[model samples]
Target: MLKLSEIQRPIERELTIFEDKFKESMRSSVPLLDRITHYIVKRKGKQMRPMFVFFSAGSCGEINDATHRGAALVELLHTATLVHDDVVDNANVRRGFFSVNALWKNKVAVLVGDFLLAKGMQLSLANDDFGMLKIVSDAVQQIIEGELLQLEKARRMDIDESIYFEVIRQKTASLIASCCACGAASTGADDATVEQMRQFGEKVGMAFQIKDDLFDFGIDDVGKPLGNDIKEKKLTLPLIHALKQVGKPEKQRIINLVKNHNDDSQKVTEVIAFVKANGGMEYASSQMLAYQQEAFNILTHLPDNAYRHGLEQLVRYTTERNK
Candidate 1:
């Protein structure tokens, strides 16, 4: 029930410092690059990943210079991925704003993404934060692998619940897990504590993605258009579950719609109704709550404090967010 502002209260000052660090790290000499970067910075979404870093650091130990750098590193990598994703998805908007590619075109957006990635690496190398670098680097690899896996599955229309989980775990959860692990590492937390934080983050991330998938079925558009995932032929948990419950012919019908007629509004409406009738949304909601509870259980293992409370609120916020 805690508001986001309340959750951020404990680390308010640290977040300011992290913001300064992030802006400084992203500074560039090229005029176009600077303009685009400034626009990105200006239109940045809630710094959820950096908040994870600072909160996890505070939960394990005191925040320090290393924690600030860790926050910056994650943000930089996250921004890079988002820019690249906009191009890949042909997404014209992000977080309800015009995407980099929408304004500057794909070529500039891709180069800017690459530059951001390099800046992240340089930040880690300059500070000798190899541990942080490794965590983010592994996450980047997993994210790319997940995107490829999802693409492959979409092409074949063969993704099941297990494959769905794997895709979300890698594409979404891995980076959030890295946020917690790197935060704990920055504070010199023991390996056990770092692992615990990572597990907690992974569960929260799972819930986060489920909520996002649910948005695809919503009446009102969030940032992206409704059924955008369906248009892209990406079968999420709801559709996957619905497909499993139906008979072979009905299943094939759904698959055929997804495969051939995904762009058709009427077909998308039919698929959405089919999913609703088959308890797909209910099942996915249950799974999202399950992951949220699992994350809360992990939080119980951490010491009691405001930072721990912040993490708990974050779990709730992730599941409850409308957009």
Candidate 2:
């Protein structure tokens, strides 16, 4: 495994460029919008999608100015989505600061999100690469659809494993797939190489999300509220799996918690304890390892390069970071 510092160095450098482009795209003398966007810009994130695009593109072909621009575009789109997500969730804090919605209210946040999305589209169109435009458009469409799909799945207490996977694929894996595709889109990588990158991204996305669910069950200071998914009455894969394994009484009890919207402060703790006692958390963690391994396996087929090593290190870092 590569050191986290080594894997993050290139990503961090690119993030500076991403922020500059992002701020430039959001250009406005209006204090509110500027303050909002600036607050969001300075609040750092992992930049996984952009790094995925950059590394994959460079490994398969020459990394150039266009590739960097494409990477910036992905980050912009992702940030826009987060702004919108905060509104949708009515969230108070993100990345340890006041959310746009929390600071400025829903309308402002919504409009800012719209502006960000429009700017992202504008940047992608500037490239005159219709292929990339279509790719990003498709990704945006999938992201919206996935959000609605997850919302639709929220009340479903009996959401099956297949349904859970479908939600994961749409809500998380699609963007990751798009990131890898954007990389290949910028390069001479053949269809096989692009497909491999997509596969890797899919597995990585799955691993990333599964670990997130496990973190909800394990970590105390994720910054976001613990088990917000469950509180919102949306049972994730681990919970769904544990529900299936339990007897009727426990299942009904869990269902009642959902039905009542779970008033108790210890609800998450109790749910987590139930999951651990029944092996749901361990099952989720094991599955995360499986997907991470799958991502690493895809790397073996590509010829050795620093980018490839960086990618492997990134894959390892995902699991280790959560651990």
Candidate 3:
């Protein structure tokens, strides 16, 4: 697999410029808000979302000011969601660093998230980037709906393959879809081309999520603790497939363990073992690969360029990454 750095060579300079612009976008008049936003920027992730935006823009037309604004808008909304998610999950850590909620408390974290969201909208509106704003705004709505749908289904523990797909499509895929759509739209691509990039991004996101699901069953020392999903009583693709393969009694027993004994290490280990024994990991892997292939197929129809190739490598990276 090509390293992300190598894949990034095509738009390396653009990404560098985007960094400064994104930081400027996060600036606030309040001193405390500035401190918190700086912390968020310093511990930023791999810049995967911006890479998607730049790549899609380059492939469709040209990397321009609108593309930069679009990438910044996506990052603002994405970071806001992550901050809110940590508060909702009551998670103290993110990417091995203390989360905003951990250092600043829930009330502060929530306000910070709101501030980031408002800043994103303001930036777009100031520049008349309504197209990009609508794209990201729609994604935000989908993510909220997805989280709510998951919570509703989680209570009943009744997520089937279809429901699972729907949840991920809305929660995870929608954001990536917007990244690609915004990228293309920023480059002044027509509706059809933008839609094509959105479809491609959605497929990659699907594969990316399935890969994350597989990590829970993996024996390797992935950053997150093993069986974290089982502990949280979240039924992912592997557990869902495993449940479908078993007899009613066995299925109920496993579900009971997940629902009640999820905190028990031994029981969680047993559930992981059951998922592996029933070919859950294999089924999920196959499904992930299928989505990856679908993403590649979409890329083939687009203009052949270094940027398109970069997008292909990014899809591979998401599925192939260890953590």
Candidate 4:
């Protein structure tokens, strides 16, 4: 496994350009919006999405202007979704800082999210990046549908493994798949290469989400509150697997606890213990590795280069990362 810094070294220059483009795209005439956007820029994450865009482009062909736009468009939509998610989750903290909704309240945050979304669309239209736009737009729609589906399942507490996969695929994997496909398309890669990268990204995204699901049960501080998913009634892979192994009565008891006492510290601890005891962690970990391997297999088809190596390291990192 390679360190993230080492993996990113291959595309550091491209990422720098992406950072500037991203910042410029977020600029607004409105003083408050500008301030909020600047705040967001200052506290941005590892730029993993844009890194994926650049690496995917480099793997298939040369990076070009369209690749930059693809990276910007993905980041714009991703940030907008995060803003809306904060409002929906009533989350005060994001990336260890106060979320936009926490600072400016729901009304401003909602508007800001809308503004970001429109800016992403405008970028695509202005550049006539319709191919990238279509990919991103489809991803956004799937993400919306995934969230709604998850919300519905969360309320019912009836999620199965298949449903869990579907939720994560739409909610998380679709965006990542679009990132790779857009990157490939931007470089004028053939349809076959674009599809291959899309598949690879989807597998990696699955592994990424599983790693995130594992964090809910981890002891280490993962930047967010532990058991946040459980509290939110989101049954992930581990818990879902554990449910399948239990007797009907035991499963019902677990479900009832999740429904009625999820917030209680003792109950959450008990649920976590039950999940671990039932081999939930092992099962989920194995599944995550399976997806990682699948992604690696797909990557083997692409022409090998430093970018491909970086992407391979990224797939490994997705499962191995503590956070």
Residues 103-131, model 2: lDDT tens digits: 88999889998888887778778877555
**Candidate 4 regions with alpha-carbon error over 4 angstroms:** 222-225
Residue 246 lDDT (model 3): 88
* lDDT of the candidates, in the order given: 0.92, 0.77, 0.95, 0.92
The collision pairs in model 1 are: none
The RMSD (Cα, Å) of candidate 3 is 1.3
Residue 163 alpha-carbon offset, candidate 3, angstroms: 0.5
TM-score of each candidate?
Answer: 0.97, 0.91, 0.98, 0.97
Winner on TM-score (1 vs 2): 1
| lDDT for each residue of candidate 4 in 31-119, tens digit (9 for 90 to 100) | 99999999999999988899899999999999999999999999999999999999999999999999999999999999999999999
**Candidate 2: what lDDT?**
0.77
Error of 1 at 62 (Å): 0.4
Off by over 4 Å in 3: 220-225
Best by TM-score: 3
lDDT of 1: 0.92
Error of 2 at 140 (Å): 1.6
TM-score of 1: 0.97
RMSD of 4: 1.5
Indicate the residue-level lDDT of 99 in model 2: 88
For model 1, the run of ten residues with the poorest summed lDDT: 217-226
